[model samples]
Target: MSPHSPARRRTAIGALAGTALVIPFLAAAPAQAAPCHLSGSTGSCNGTVHQPGSPGEGGGSGGNSGGGSGPVAPPAPVGLNPNQGQGFVQVPGNQAPPPPAKPATADLVAQAQAAAAFPVPIVHTAPKGKTFVRLRTSLWVDGFHVVKTQPITVGAQTVQLTGEPATVTWDLGEATRTCDNAGSEDGKACSYTYQRSSAGQPGGAYQITATIRWNVTWSCEGADCDEAGGDLGQQPMQSEATPLVVGEIQTTTGQ
Candidate 1:
């Protein structure tokens, strides 16, 4: 019949099927795998993986990892004892503060002055004679004792201040003299013999004044130290003025 017949087509199809089966058998196959190894906090295939300990890992009681819920906070620090600490002792909130600092020296001095720490100057001897004669004199405190150790409280501090005469300064109306450590005794060492009559001076007499210097010191219950303004050293304490009459001695020998 025709060149292309049914028999011829069936023969061609049979040959194609046989060729496809042989080609699949000729293709290459996959290679074999190497062994997998693991170490502490690390793993490796052909490459490796590593994890290290974080800083302050063992400082406190807490987990190192931050994976669970959230991070674990470290323990609280321990407090120190105030009485046993090495450096500066810590003051407790409940502890009472030290007694207020001692009052200033100037304050103590003012208190003493207010209390009349030094007694009024007393003239032991009065001058009664003509010019050229040595004026016999003495000066002293009437009470001649401490200021009774008066206690003066300022702010929160209390200081006891005691005072007494340390020196005496004399104003002879015409001249002045300062005697140290001279209290309650004959003042002959500091005496002055007037050379002229009182007619030249007011009231026809010399007006004499004695000033006593008070030496003050202060202290607290626990310390013997002086207050800041205490120890005013030598403070001038004055006395009322006294009049002395000096007349010229008459010499009616050879008229």
Candidate 2:
């Protein structure tokens, strides 16, 4: 038989046909997923987890959802869906809600005042803690940063009430006196003359209280400062009780 004969040509044709048939069996297989290595509370997906049944994905495809904008169960391979409360993947620290908004200016003053911790009034007296009946007892206060300047946050601005003494109303047991300023120990400004002695009272003393009225005005700053900043309204702060001994005078009348 010759090399160019029909028998030789037929054998070559069969070999080419066999090679073509095996090519379909050698076609590529579907890709295997990358393995995930979770180290701690936080982990990363080896490849992005494409959660099925999400918005664009058709309903009930891979997940149990009827679908619409709802959270679907994610793959458990990458530690997903562990902390999910609402059916979505819960990444730590990424889900914190925003903080509360600042209150309106009108509501801010009273709210700030209630929250502010202005110092309480400090009480002081003249006559070195003792006095004589029918004598000028000279009752007064030590003030000591009384009429406290309090800085409060109203909206975005800082408002401060005046620290200067306003009115100190002294309850002197027998009489009440209000001073335009912190009372003076000298007989001039805020002196109170006791008509009766405190000898009959408990511990031979009169328990005195000073109520300080603070100047309430708010000065505003910052770009958001408003006309609402002025005159937040006055508030009264009372002082702790102080003790004063009043002794009766002994006078000898000529017989």
Candidate 3:
């Protein structure tokens, strides 16, 4: 039993050999899942465990459990094309949206008539149905708004129409004249001088009339600009006729 004895050495060697065999068995044991606390019959294990029906690695439904880069994304749903884009379907640059439908001219004309602010002819001199033969009878009308068109929307496109006074026409029951500007109340424009009396006319007065003509245009914005656009031509509005009488002044020569 002495520390240096042959029997003691042999015993020490046998103990060392036993320790080596036990160390290999410990190393070969399966690793344990951390936080594996068991409470009664039900407990939780953090380590991977195969359920009775669950596929392990390549054995399960979606991907092979044997693994390379991780589970392949399930095949894109049937009939859907898979895209590499970030959640968006890429559109071709050459595809262009269709233009809006053209608006009906008749419909626009009706709308313009409803929205138009018409001007009545002002008989500056012939208001009382009488005027001097040698003096000019003044008549004019204001150039008011014809207003904006109702918005026309087709698909993703929209259009709005607008109008402006373009011409004015004057009728004196015998002659007609057109002007580039609206009639002026200053008597410099839209005045007519009677060369003769209105004795032969109906109601003993000549009928006078004034009309305003507007030109309409339309515009669009954004991607639909210039679509469903057109001109509405000349939309004319006339004022009621006024009866005017031209009389001659009789003066006797003094003796």
Q: Best by lDDT, which number?
A: 2
Go through the candidates in order and give each one's C-alpha lDDT.
Answer: 0.57, 0.66, 0.63
Q: Where does candidate 3 have its weakest 10-residue lDDT segment? A: 62-71
Q: Ranking under lDDT, best-scoring first?
A: 2, 3, 1
Of the two candidates 2 and 3, the one with more favorable TM-score, higher being better, is: 2
CA RMSD (A), model 3: 14.3
Clashing pairs in 1: 105-228, 105-229, 105-230, 106-229
Please give the distance, in angstroms, between residue 231's alpha carbon in candidate 3 and its true position after superposition.
2.6
TM-score of 1: 0.46
Q: 99-150 in candidate 2: lDDT tens per residue?
A: 7775555565555566655557777666778888878766566643544345
Best by TM-score: 2
| Candidate closer to the true structure by TM-score (higher is better), 1 or 3 | 3
* Cα distance off (Å), candidate 1, residue 245: 0.9
Instruction: Give the per-residue lDDT of model 3 (tens digit) for 155-247.
Output: 445556677777778887757777666556556766777778888888888887778777877665445344456775767778777777777
The backbone clash count of each candidate, in order, is: 4, 0, 4
The sequence of per-residue lDDT tens digits that candidate 1 reaches over residues 47-105 is 54423343323323332343212345776556856456477585668677688665665
Model 1 residue 153 lDDT? 65
Q: Model 1: residues >4 Å from true position, as ranges? A: 1-116, 127-145, 153-157, 181-190, 222-230
